[model samples]
Target: MSWVPVAVSLGFAGLTVLACCSFKVFLGVRRFGRELERTKRRLGPKHAALRDELHDLPEPRAARSPGDGVPSV
Candidate 1:
């Protein structure tokens, strides 16, 4: 039973390492989310302007018949 303490200590060390890695992953994801939000905010006005410009464009004229431009006899 003397090896039980050594096993317990190793288990604790493994758990500590897993917890640290999980915390670091959490921090990285949080930072990525913040960057995405910042980029959205920066580009929001340009996106709106482009949408408005697209809406303001005049529609295409209707297609003409093949002989529509010919003069009558």
Candidate 2:
């Protein structure tokens, strides 16, 4: 019946909405962290294999030529 009561109710509603959204964001972050950990665990072995394979590959050497700077058309 008073403006004061209406303002208080509106403020409470806003706070409730904010609290709900914050909770949702927290859940989302937690889920993302868990999924990230799972993905890393799944890829760990393959990642190591790739690293070992890469290590055994030939190393790159800079190409040097007697006339390297000169273009031969």
Candidate 3:
């Protein structure tokens, strides 16, 4: 019965450490997510501009003759 208190104390300490580590990891992930959102926001306008520029470019045509694939009469 004497060892029970020691075991309980050790278990509680272990759990506390585990919880602290988990909370730290959660905070880091949250910070990373916030930074990622900020980056996307900053790039969104540039991405849209580039997309518009691409849309304004002329389309390329195939090099083959128009009647090359037609069947003989």
Strongest candidate by TM-score:
2
- For candidate 1, give the lDDT of residue 40: 100
RMSD of 3: 5.9
Ranking by TM-score: 2, 3, 1
**Candidate 1: Cα lDDT at 63:** 94
Q: Which stretches of model 1 miss by more than 4 angstroms?
A: 60-73
TM-score head-to-head 1 vs 3, winner? 3
TM-scores across all candidates? 0.74, 0.80, 0.77
Write candidate 3's Cα lDDT for 1-73 as tens digits.
9999999999999999999999999999999999999999999999999999999999987688867887787
Q: Go through the candidates in order and give each one's C-alpha lDDT.
A: 0.98, 0.96, 0.96
Query: Which parts of model 2 are misplaced by more than 4 Å?
Result: 64-73
Question: Candidate 1 lDDT, tens digit per residue, 2-69?
Answer: 99999999999999999999999999999999999999999999999999999999998999987889
lDDT tens digits, residue span 1-73, model 2: 6999999999999999999999999999999999999999999999999999999999987889778687867
